[model samples]
Target: MLTIDSLSHRLSSYLEPTQINRVKRAYYYAEQAHAGQYRRSGEAYITHPLAVANILASIHMDHQSLMAAMLHDVIEDTGIGKAAISHQFGEQVANIVDGVSKLAKIEYETQAEKQAKNFQKMAMAMARDLRVIVVKLSDRLHNMRTLGALPAEKKRRIAKETLEIYAPIAHRLGMNDWRIEFEDRGFAAMHPLRATRLHASLQQVRGNRKTLVEKIQAAIELRLQRESIDGLVIGREKHLFSIYNKMRSKHKSFKEIMDVYAFRIIVEDIDTCYRALGAIHNLYKPKPGEFKDYIAISKENGYQSLHTVIIGTQGVPIEVQIRTKEMDELASRGVAAHWLYKSSGDDDSASAGSYDRANRWIKRLLEIQQHTNSSVEFVENVKIDLFRDEVYVFTPKGEIIELPAGSTPVDFAYAVHTQVGNTCVACRINDRPAPLSQQLESGQKIKIISSEKSQPNPNWLNFVITAKARAAIRHYLKNQRHTESVELGKRMFMRALTNNNLQFDQLNHDQITGLLEKTTSESLDEMYESVGLGRITALTITSILLPDSDENRDGTGITPISIESPDSLLISFARCCRPIPGDPVVAHLSTGKGVVVHREPCKNVSDLRSKKESLSDISWSPNVTGEFLTIIRVEVKSERGIIASLATRIANTGTSIEGIQVDERDAENSVITLTVAVTSRVHLANVMRSIRNMRSVTSVGRPKT
Candidate 1:
């Protein structure tokens, strides 16, 4: 039912005459483009754009934004092209329109992929120009308003999308009014019975509490007046969706949910907001530990307020929010408040600052997209970042850093800078040394310690919470694995050549080039890197690179040995026995996993030996060399020098003790477990024998595998 006249009238209030004419021109052009098209509701398609434009006008968006909203669907639904829009309106308008357009022409594997792709596109577009999202939000708002025309299945799908994505986006942007409306509408479409019951309950509650709410409002107003603080007191109704969420999350019934009747007090300034809080507290007792001051530390979405729970008449618990006029405007309208201030010729700096703060997360999404190539992964990460509650911590310099709740020091390091995260070695929380995975709390000061030689630990990914940290860590680990794999591949190839008595100097450029081409690698280095990364087995590459005569020599030339590499990254030793080089070994070809080598006598190996199809014969190569892990149990007299003597004897036998733990201690004797690094099983036995020769040592033996 919306018309061009209503949109024009709305625009006339803030837009200049020329700008209004431009918007009008876009309207007429869109009408012509959709002359024969009708919506599912049997209205002219042009009405949809007009309604969308009206929504933007209500938010006082700029002329360019309004034009984009009007012409948003033209590129996707009509014959009009982006070039034509650019020629007619300008690049900015054309870009915004293009940004909001969906990729309907392209085919996707599934509905989820298509949706993820669209959201990814929208996220990228919003990063470039935030106006695109504002316009898209307006477009979706009109669509949702008229969603009844669609089939039930489609309605549920769109409503679910709105609830999960659009509503959260609105909340992130500080558009509380739009966010609440979206949630309510989506809830009605997705769960009609629940929505109806909740609505009825809310209405009944309102009817029963009308008098009590009025009394509380009057009391708050009178207290503010008595304190000489000018304020506007209003009853704030709880949204049904929010109530439903609380019920579901807290497992509470409708009647059990308190704070159903909330109130807000909008004052003249920040100081007056605090004074109003004090006045209200004087009039009504505030509940213990229920006050929050957001004025000093605003939310990630730029919302600021003073929140407190108070016991009002009849001992009813009521939630109260106090904020200044500007803060209230922001709490209601969010980023839309920027347009309102701009159109009124208010301070540009304050508006820009607010917009920048809200835009930071959107910009971060774009950065994450650059590192993430999977549509599903990008969508999941975006959801994680959007839905979690945030915690505020501080840097060593006292600057506040906001992160998701349950974030760790590693997440903090990445939030500061990518390089800092890559090089982070350790961190201190609250001036005390803390683990990198320590869950950060609000108000704690964090100082990251970095070393140039340090690289990201793959284990960090297990606990990191933020998208940036997760994506950055994964990207770095992937690259690091490639680098190590390439080096290992090169070394394996050399060992193959040595076993065949064929030196690298014997191979000509043509042979190397042929080898690279056969492996589908760009260069020799890439082939080696691939081998090291386990993409292609070194044995396979060695067979291809060596002559048939060399290949026929004993299987010893290519036998898998000492899964360990120079960097200790290409292979991992099974923790069951911590196998050394001299132990007989077998490799298990796990699906989607490279070969895992285990000692032949290991209990785990014994259990898996039944699956002969998955087991491959492996042994230690003559050239194999690296430190191996082993545990030793030692029982000694409970004397001070006994511990030092055991360590000295072990060191004398060329073994290094990595760690030691006392199993038991008494007045005469003690038991200790030592994790030692040795070159081979023989080396470990020698060290154990050396320790056993000591007078204080009652027993020395390898720990049970």
Candidate 2:
């Protein structure tokens, strides 16, 4: 039914000679490069590229993008490379091709990991060069359109990926038209039954509303003609998946979801958009609070449009979007819209700067990759940042900062400045004091109260949003851990002298260094860190340090045994369960790993009892005077500031914490379990009673077992 000549004629007004020549050249080159390749559908593989290029051209892309679109698969499927493409076309086209080609190289161990990492790369690349994603999206669009020949399993995989990754990316880029298509197609492939039902419902609605749409279009066109405003009006039906999402998310029936039918009014200029909006409002009653003027405050992705929802004929709610012809092109094609405007000889140097801010987040990915070594963590961080919902907030000066949805004030503080986040002590939302973990909503003005004395609280790690905030908090905690371990190692070394009946000055540094080297530890300092982290123990080092112990233990009634006794053995504490300050505990001697202490009733420790060979009796020292780790149970009511206030209150008692576990979700009560390090039973009792007296706190006691 459609011919090339007929399609060309339809596009004659916009397709200039230069564009046509490039398209022809690209066609010839792609055809040769993909000569031997055939698609699963039995069509020449070159046809796929051509189809994608045709999609781009339909959106009025310029010559360079068209060339890149045609040659996108040449490098991947064919043996063509970036260098060859650069030699044939210019570096610009080659760059686009290379970006897409790099994305095709990602191989992951899992499907989720693969999809997440692929999207991450694509996102970063698109942020750098928007054209890269436009080309890839167009390519995917064509592939999705022609996926009939693929197996059902493959179809579902690609479709689900498109729904999760591509559609969201399209939405972020503000490609509304393309977004709807991608979502609908993906939804159809993923949920065929739902898609079929939705399609049937839409068909029914279309049949019933045919007369209404015609009457509305005629009325609008006649009015525009009378006003001498030249423009195009196209009716847009709501996509099935979108309707499904709305129904699922909002719990609405199909009939309850208004604005299912909309009209796009494309004109020549911005002034005409407003004029058309006025005209449309005059024709129908406008819905209250349903108007958005994105033209004035364009989104981060360069989307600009005037939107309104109106009660159309028969009290049917209809959405209307007005934009210029250029805006429409950008709205549909997004970054690829650059290609269309570039052919007009417009100076793009100034306009290019508009996209720089959007690309900054992408640049951060490269920065993150440099710091991180593990692929799984990298993929995880990228996914957390990308797929997370967003909340738009304003700074003191009215500058907008978009953060992940459910982001606390801490994330906002970090978004402003890393220093501010690190030192953030308090916050104010809309001129009132708020907690750091308060969920930020759209349009709220926020202010962070910071202090030089303020350090990152471990509790803050539980509630902060945004990957950057989480990563920063984690990094800080790791650094803090290193610092604390170093300090603790020094103290433990000093304290051991009394137990060993040795003077610190009498120990040989060279001998100690040699002992550390045999264990493959870096230095005395590193050995100390290992000891503090419970990797090695005091007895293990004492044996290595005092190996010439014949003089020291000759008449003390003590004999060195090849295997340590199950009783009277020093054990290294497990931080996993952190049998802290005053908890009943026992030890398990792991082969070649020394003794590992655990809570007496801990499942991990209990499981080890079956292996009697590895079992060891561990008891608290009779002279134990310093702090020990204990997990205490504290019950409290869940409310804002409870965690922060509790943490502050606990810290005020000069007690260090091993960890805090909160599960305050039973019957309107919050149960908080805290693992604290305290000097004695007296100190722990005081701390427990103090916590019990605090507001919202009901009961505080040690674990009964």
Candidate 3:
């Protein structure tokens, strides 16, 4: 049904004669490479690539992109190599083909992993040349079109990936045509029954509404004509996937959604576009607060238009959009639009601006990639940002920043810069003090209050919505843990050395190198990190350095490490027993969690003590200066102001109530669970005594498991 000659004829309208010839040459080369190969549908394999090239041509892609589309599958399907493609076509075309080819040389444990790795490879290639994604998108479009020959399960997998990734990517790049096509086909393949039912419903509704829709279109056309505003008026068709989504997401009947008539008015230029909008509003009163001027503040994807809702004739609602011809074209082709690839003048500034915005999005993906170590983690982080509903907020300086809805100041901080996010301690929204976790709304000005001594809180990950912010927070915490672990391991080894009377300064470079090799560690720092993370013990390494057979011995008479700094990243107090200052505690070496301190009598520590290598003796330092969290349970007689009175009493103890909950309640007695911060065990006892003095409080004591 398709051929190279047919595509060449179509390309002749815009592409040069030489460029068309080059595309033809690439086609013939691909044909020879796969001479005897046939596709699953029993057609010549060459047809697929040719179809892909045609798709690219429809967007008027440059010659190199078309050529790359033609030879995209040659390296994967045939014995041909990338070097041959490079030699035949130019290096740029070959690189694109390689980028688009399926990289399935190695075995993978699961489908998701394989997909993530392949996507990661493609993302790298995409960063190198933006055209690679354009060609790859075309290749995927052709595959999706021909997926009927595949098994049902395979079809669903491909369809899901297309909807989850490719379609959203197309939308983000401003390629509305490809994105809609992808969504419609992917939806159908993924849910054939639902799609079939929705399509039939749409067909029935279209027939019933055809007359009314035409009448509305005609009315708008007449108004524009009378106003001397030249424009093209046409009713817009709702894609099947969009209609289905609206039905499900909005929980509306098909008829309710169909009731809204949609139309587009394409004008000759920007000024006329606004004039046409005003004329339409005068014809039918526009619904208040329903107008959006995307023309002035374009979307992050570079889409520009004026959208409005008005009460049409017969009390029906009409949704209308007005835009210039160029803007409409860009909406379809997005970054692949021919104008973006060419040189720009004052008239082409919109195209150039749109292209730059697309580049910024791609580079953001690169930043996320750099912070991720696992391909799976990277894909998971990336998926979080794919479906952003934008909320435009401004900086104090009046520059607009586009962010996803429900994004917090932490998300905004990371968006500004990674360092700003890492150092941000507080925020001022609209010049008034606000919590950092407050969700930002449109038009609000944000000012981040940062401190030089601040570091990212791991808790930020629970609230920050953007992929960039989450990744940066994770990156900082992970690196911080490693640095702290190494320092703790070195300190532990120093204590071991003091006990053995072996000085760390006395060890030579060769001795340290030998010790690292003995542990199969790459460097001395890595061995220390291993020790700190509990992978190996400090005493073991100290014995290796001294070889003093008695030094490796475990148990009694060793000086316990003083936990003077309770807030050390390497030392974490266990929650189960909640051991505070002056409590007798023992430390357990948890792999990857440097040290976990538990009360000496804790049930968990009973079994852990048998493993001598894992258990260590630890003591609290005098004058430790941090608040420790402890839970206080109180049984109170049924009365008013019980919770408020307890909160006040807790606050009167020179501290504040951290949290409060009612665990169990009856008509006579109510159990109140209060989480309070105290300086020490003595301070906690005094708070409990103060609460016990209240008459409503029947009993007050600490709860232990």
Candidate 4:
């Protein structure tokens, strides 16, 4: 039903005669290109682009954006090319259209991979020109609005993608109109039952509280007039998705969601905004700890308001937001307000400031993309960075750094600079020494302690919340693993050579090159790194470097066993079965895991036994002495001091209990599992026997291999 005339009419408000003509030219060109195509709804495809252009026009986007929206699908959906678009329109218009198009020439392994690649391309385009995303959002908005025409499964998939990807992006860019609508529409499509229930509940509440809300609005308007304040008091109901989220997250019923009905007081200036807040607080008792003054410290998205909850008549709680007209416009329209102002040729500093503030996150997204490699990783990190509850902390210099909730000092350091994060050793929070993983709170001043020798610890990846921090830590740890693996591989290769009675100096360049080629490695360092990383065994490379003249007649081959040295970092015991000095064990060559010693009956060993070449005959040396973890289950009478008695008996055997868990329990007895550190299987057996000797403990045995 929508047509190009409606789009032209919407654009005519701000666009000049010349620009309006250009837009019309673009629309006709796109119309011809998409003449024979039809959408799922059986409507002419030109309607879709026109509808998309109309959506942008509603936000007062510039003529170029509107034209780009109109012609966005021409090159991708039609025989037209970017060159044709450039010849018809200008290069900028052609570039914008091309930016919105997905890479159709490439094949992808999966739908998710294809989606990730498209998002990657769109992000790059958005970085080059912000208008690309604006138009893209408009395109998505129109598609979502008419999503019912698609198949059920396709509808769900598209709706889910919109909710997860496009909606968050709209929020990050402060496009509240598009963001809220996207969420509401997507929620309705993706979760029809919940959306319907919520809508019905909202409507019922609206019917019941219609008079109350009107009375409250009247009372506030009267009070403001009495104080000689110029204010427009408007009543608002919370968005359905917002209300649903609150109910779901807080586990509250519809009626218990008190802030469902809210009021916004729009004043003329910032001082008046505060004055209005004071007036409202005086009029009604404000709920304690429910007041936030965002005017002093606006949200990262440039939203500023004074939010308060107060007890009104009949003990009913009412939420109120007070802000200036400018704040209200920004809150309602977000970044679209800047476009509106730009299209109207209103170069106001406030509008420009708001635009800049909203765009800071986009710059941060670019930084994240720079540090990330895989499309899936980039998309995932972008999602994490997008949907975060922010906490605003301060640096030593008093500058505010807004980070995601649960972000630690390490995340802060990384947010400050990649170099700072890499070299960060410790932090001082509120002038007290704090762990790097300490979660930061708002208003706390933090100072990062750095040392030139300090490098990122792999453990930091466990707690860092920000995507930037996680990406940087992962990048650093990857490089560190490569370096360490290379060194370990070199040592392993040399040891293999020495065991074979061949000196490393005896190998010539030609032989070394041949070895590298045989191993499919680029250089000696790569070969050594691969061996160290467990990608290949040292014995395999050694055999290639020095093959035996006679073919092997014995079953497979045997490698020397060595687990005695205290500092043998290349060998590690697999925690899956905890093979000790006296336990039957086998060494499995695992990629990037070095030589792993597992119990002979380990499930992993059985699974990998088909590859006989990768198995190495290994055993713990006679002097293999060190503490290893072993799990033992004990059946004990359910009574006080039973755990204490078990612990005492294990300690009496010189073994230390590391962990305990109540695996299963009843009124009479409980199965308690204990993980204790012992020197060998014999030590663990002696400890289990000591625990079994306790009167409270009925039976004790180790878990099956």
- Index of the highest-TM-score prediction: 3
Q: Give the TM-score of candidate 4.
A: 0.82
Model 3 C-alpha lDDT per residue in residues 144-195, reported as the tens digit of each score: 8989999998888888888888898888888999999999999999999999
Model 1 quality (TM-score):
0.85
In candidate 3, stretches whose alpha carbon ends up further than 4 angstroms from where it belongs are 102-109, 338-347, 508-511, 545-569, 600-607, 610-613, 621-625, 652-654, 663-670, 681-686
Sum up the clashes in candidate 2: 8
Predicted candidate 2 versus true structure: per-residue lDDT over 1-705, tens digit per residue? 333344355446677766676666777888899998999988777778777777776777666777888888888888888898999888988989877876773433356566556655675667557789878888888878987899998888788777766777676655667888898899889889999988888788778778888878888888788778887988877778878998999999987873356888899988999888888888889999899787776655667789999987778888889998767766665655555566666745323423453466566555555434455566666666656666678998999887877899999988887678889999999999988888998789999988996778778878986767766766666666666555544555554444467766788889767777876787777876665565665455665766765432211222111212122123346766655534566655454334567777877765665543334344555555545677788888878889888888889899877788888576678888888877766788788877888988888887754
Model 1 worst lDDT run, 10 consecutive residues: 102-111
lDDT of 1 by residue, 189-270 (tens): 9999999988988898788878888988888888888999998999988888989999999999888784456999988888
Off by over 4 Å in 4: 103-110, 258-260, 433-438, 501-509, 549-573, 576-589, 597-705
Q: Is candidate 1 or candidate 3 better by lDDT?
A: 3
lDDT of 4 by residue, 304-362 (tens): 89999999988888889998887877776677778888877778555676678656777
Worst 10 residues of 4 by lDDT: 549-558
- In the order shown, the candidates' Cα RMSDs to the true structure are 5.7, 8.3, 2.7, 5.4
Q: How well does model 4 score by local distance difference test? A: 0.81
Q: What is the lDDT of every predicted structure here? A: 0.82, 0.72, 0.85, 0.81
Tell me the number of clashing residue pairs for each predicted model.
3, 8, 0, 0
TM-score between candidate 2 and the true structure: 0.72
